[model samples]
Target: MAKLLEIRWHGRAGQGAKTAALVLAEAAISAGRYAQAFPEYGPERMGAPMQAFNRISDEPITVHSHVTNPSIVVILDPTLIAATNVKAGVPADGIYLVNTTMGPCEMRKRLGLTDSPAKVYTLDATQISMDTIGRAMPNTPMMGALVGATGLLELDQLIADTREKLGRKLRPEIVEKNIEAIRRAFQEVAS
Candidate 1:
C-alpha cells in the first residue's frame, strides 16, 4: 500500500490555496497515486480565510471526511497563525510549512508559540514570490518549501507539474520565474 499524505491549507481566498491543493493532488496522481483535492468555502469573498485539503495514497481513498489529522499543514498566510488555530488537529509530529523569514527560534518568539512537537520549515515565500513572480501571492513559492521540507516528490517533477497546472493562469515569463523559485528552494534544502 502506498503511504498516505493528508495536507491542509490555510490561506485567504484568491491566494491560490485551492490551486495549490489541486496542483499537489494532480502531481501525486501523475506520479501514480490516488489523490483528491477540495476546499472548504466560507463567507465566499476574496481575502476571507479558507481552507483546502488534499489526500494522496497508493490505495484508493474511500473516505469522504474532512481532514482533521493532516500530516502536512501549510500556512500560506503568516497572520492565520494568529487568526486561527492553525495547529489544530495536527499530530504531535506533523510537519508545518509556514511562509515566513523568521528562523524557527525567532518564529517561536514572534508568534509567542509554546513548544510543540510538530517540526516546522519556515521560509520567506512572500518575498520569494514577489521577487520571482513579481507578486505577493505565494502559492508557487510555498510549493518549493513543501518540496524542500519533505521529499514527497521530485522537485523537478513538481515544478513541471506546477507549470502545466498554472500555465494558462500565468504568463510564460511568470512561469519561468516560478521554476527558478522552485530551483532556489530545492537548493536551499540541500545547503
Candidate 2:
C-alpha cells in the first residue's frame, strides 16, 4: 500500500473484534507491513457495542490515536446496523464489509450508501462461522472477507498467521475449523 490504510471494526463485545484486529495486525507484520491494532471499550459486558482499529502501511506507523476516518469499515454484527452508526468516519471512497445475509445492493440501501461512492460488500459470516467453527464468532471470517474485498493480504498467509495465533490458546480442531470459516467467507462474500 502506497498510503496508510486504516480499518475500523465494529462488533459486539464477545464477537472477537479485538482478536480479529490483533490477528490482522500480526498477519500484516508477517507480510512485512508495518501495522498496529487496538480496541476501544469501557465497562461494556458481553453483546455490548465495541470497536477495534487497525493501521497498516508499507512504512512504519506513527499516528497513535483512534481511527476517525477509515478506509475500510467492517461490521461483524448485522444487528449493530440498527443501533450503531457503522459508517462513522468512513470516507467517500471507503469500503464496507458487513456480516449479513443481505447482498451488497441491499446493504447499500440499508447503509444509505446508494448514492455514495463507497463500496459495500456483504456475507453471512455468522452462518459461515457456525457451520465451520461450530460457533458464532465472525472475526476470522470477516478478516477473510476483508482480504476478498481488497486483496490486501495473501489469504493463505493470513490463515497461517491466524492459525499460529489461535493455536496458542485454542485446540487444533477448533483452529482448523476457524481456518475453514475464513476460507469460506473469502469465497462466499458478496461484492
Candidate 3:
C-alpha cells in the first residue's frame, strides 16, 4: 500500500497557513508526488482562527475531506494552542511542529503532553520571520519546520517552488527573504 501523509495547519486568517499548505502541496507535486491542499476558514476576518489541510502520497489520492486524524500538525500561531484543542485528533505518535520561542521540552510541559507518545518540536519561527522577512508572519518559516519534522519533501525543492510561485506576485527581495526564513526554520527547529 502507498503511504499517505496527512497534515493539518492551524493559524489565523492573515498568517498564511493556507498559503503554506498550498506551497507544500505544490512542492510535493513538483517532486513527483501526489498531493492536495485546501483550507477551512471561520469568520473570514484577519486574526480569526482557521485551518488548512494537506494530503501527500506516493500514489494518487481519492479522498477529499478535512483531515480529522493528522499524522502531522503545524501550529503557526502559539496563541491558538490555548484557544483551540490543537491535539484534538492527533494520534499518540503524531508529530507537532509549533512556531514559538519555546523549546520542545518546554512546549511539552506547557501542552501537558510531557509523557505522551507524540513528538513535539518547536522553533522561534516568528522571530525568524521577523528577522528574515521583516514581518512576524510565521507561515513560511513553519513550512520549513514542517519539512524538517516530516521529511516528506526535499528542502531544496520547497525553496525553489516557493520562489517560483511567490516571485510572480512579490518583489525579488521579499521572495529571497521568505526562502531564507524557510532555510533558517528548517535548520533551527528543535525536538
Candidate 4:
C-alpha cells in the first residue's frame, strides 16, 4: 500500500489552521490526488487551542481517526511550543514547520531536536502576513511555507486554489494581498 501523507496543524482558533488544511486538500484534489481536510475544535471561542488535519495519497485514504502520527506537523504559533507538547505523536524523522522569527537551528534546540533526525523549519509568518496583508493572520503564509518546504503540491496550484477560495468573501485587493503573502513566505521559509 502507498503511504498516505498525514499533516497535523496546531494553532489558536482565530488563526488559519483550518483554512490552510482545507486549501491544501483542495489543491491536492485539483492535482488529481485523493485528499481530506478536517478540523478539531475545542470550546467555541477565539484564542482556544485547535487542530486541523490533512491526509493526501495517490490512493484513497482509509484511516479516519485523528492524526496521531503525522509525517508533517505545522505549528502556526511558536508559543504553542512552550504551552503544549507540540511534538506529540511525531515520528523521530517527522518534519516540524513552525511560524516564528527563530532560525531553524535555534528552533531545533528549543524543541530539543538538536540530536534528532527530524527536520525543523521556521519563518516569521506573522511578519510576512502583516507586511503583505496588513494583518497578523499567519495561515496563508504558513501554508505557502509548507508548500515551499515539502513540495506536496505545486506552488501555482496552491495559489490558484487560495485565490479562488478567498475571493468569494474578500475584496479584490485583500485577496491579492493574501496571494502576495503566500508567494513571499514560499521564498522566505528557512529550513
Candidate 5:
C-alpha cells in the first residue's frame, strides 16, 4: 500500500499558512508524489484563525477532502492557539511543528497538552524570515523545516521546486534569498 500523509495548518489569515500548504504540495508533486493542497477559509478577516490541508501519497489521491486527522500539524501563527483548537485532530504519534520563540516545553504547556505524546518542534521561523527574507512571509522556510522533520523529500527537490515555483515571480536576488532562508530553516529550525 502506498503511504499517506496529511498535514493541517493553523494560523491567522495573513500568516501565509495557506501558501505554506500550497507550496508544500507543489514541492511534493515535483518530487513525484501525489499531492493535494487546499485551504478552509472562514471569515475573511486578517487576524482570524484559518486552516489549510494537504494530503500526500505515493499513489494517486482520490479523496479531495479536508483533513480530519492529520499526521502533521503546522502552526504558522502561535497566537492562533488562543482562538483555535489546533491540537484536537492531531494523532498521538504524529509531529507538531509550530513557529514561535518558545521552545518545545513552553509550547506544549501553552497548548495545554499533558497526556499526549506527540512530538513537537518549535522554531522562530518568523524571525528567521525577517532576518533572511526581509519579510514575515514564512511559508517557504516552514516548508523547509517540514521537509527536514518528515524526510518526505530531499533538500535538492525542495530547492528545485522553490526555484521553479517562485523564481519567475521574483527577482534573482529575492529568489536566492528565499532559497537561502529555506536552507537555513531546514538546518537550524528543523529539530
Candidate 6:
C-alpha cells in the first residue's frame, strides 16, 4: 500500500470483470483507502471482450484515464492470451493472475512467457466458481486471486465487502457461495 497499485482486468462480457473491479475498489475504499474503478467496453454485448481498470493507493488518485501500465493484470479468460496481447505494457516485475485450468508452468510455456520477468500465477477459477457458486463466472474468484497475488488488501476484508456489496442484489445463498469461491480461489491460486 505504499505506492499506487494499478490493476487491469481482461474478460469477456457477462464474466463480471467490471463487477469485480468495482467490488475491489469498494473494498479498498471501505478499508479507508483511495481507489478508482471503471470499465472500457467494445461492442457492448455478452461474450464481447472488455477491459476494466482499478487504482488503489494510500493517497488520492489524481489521474482519470485508462491504465496502460498496470502493476498487476488479471485475466479472467485464458482465451484472451491468444486473442490479444494480454501482457502489453506490463513491466518485468509485474504479476499476472490468470484464470485457467492449466498450471502456472504450463501457462507460462503456453503464453511463451518463460523468459519474461513478470511472475505468472494460474487458478482454475471457473471450476472453483462452478463448484462453489454453481456457475462459471470467474470474476469473484479472480478477485480473490488478485488479493492473494498482490496482498493489496486482507482476505477477510475482501470477503466482508463482497458479501455486503452483493448481498443487496443477490440471494443469501449465492452470496455465501461466492464468498466460498473467493476463499478457495485465494488459497488455490498457484505461482
Each model's lDDT comes to 0.82, 0.93, 0.91, 0.92, 0.83, 0.92
Q: What would the per-residue lDDT of candidate 4 be over residues 1-191, giving only the tens digit for each residue?
A: 13699999999989989999999999999999999999996675888788999999999887888888888999999888888888898999999999999999999999999999999999999999999999899999999999999988899999999999889888989999999999999999998
Candidate 6: give its CA RMSD in angstroms.
Answer: 1.0
Model 6, residue 177: what's the lDDT?
Answer: 97
For residues 1-191, write the lDDT of model 2, one tens digit per residue: 64899999999999999999999999999999999999997998999999999999999888888899998999999889999998887889899999998989999999999989999999999999989988789999999999988899999889999999999999999999999999998998887
Q: Give per-residue CA lDDT, model 3, range 125-150, as digits (tens).
A: 99999999998989989988888877
By the TM-score metric, which is better: model 1 or model 4? 4
How far residue 73's Cα lies from its native spot in candidate 4, in Å, is: 0.7
Q: What residue pairs are clashing in model 1?
A: none
Candidate 3, poorest ten consecutive residues by summed lDDT: 1-10
For each of the candidates, give the backbone clash count: 0, 0, 0, 0, 0, 0
Model 5, global lDDT = 0.83
Q: Each model's TM-score? A: 0.91, 0.98, 0.97, 0.97, 0.92, 0.97
Q: What CA RMSD would candidate 4 show?
A: 1.3
In model 6, the clashing pairs are none
State the lDDT of candidate 1 residue by residue for 58-125, as single tens digits: 88999999999998888899888888988788887787788877776666555545486667778887
**lDDT of model 5, residue 87:** 76
Which portions of model 6 miss their true places by more than 4 Å? none
Q: What TM-score number comes out for model 4?
A: 0.97
> Once superposed on the true structure, which residue ranges of model 1 sit more than 4 Å away at CA?
109-115, 189-191
Residue 28 shift from truth in candidate 1, angstroms: 0.7
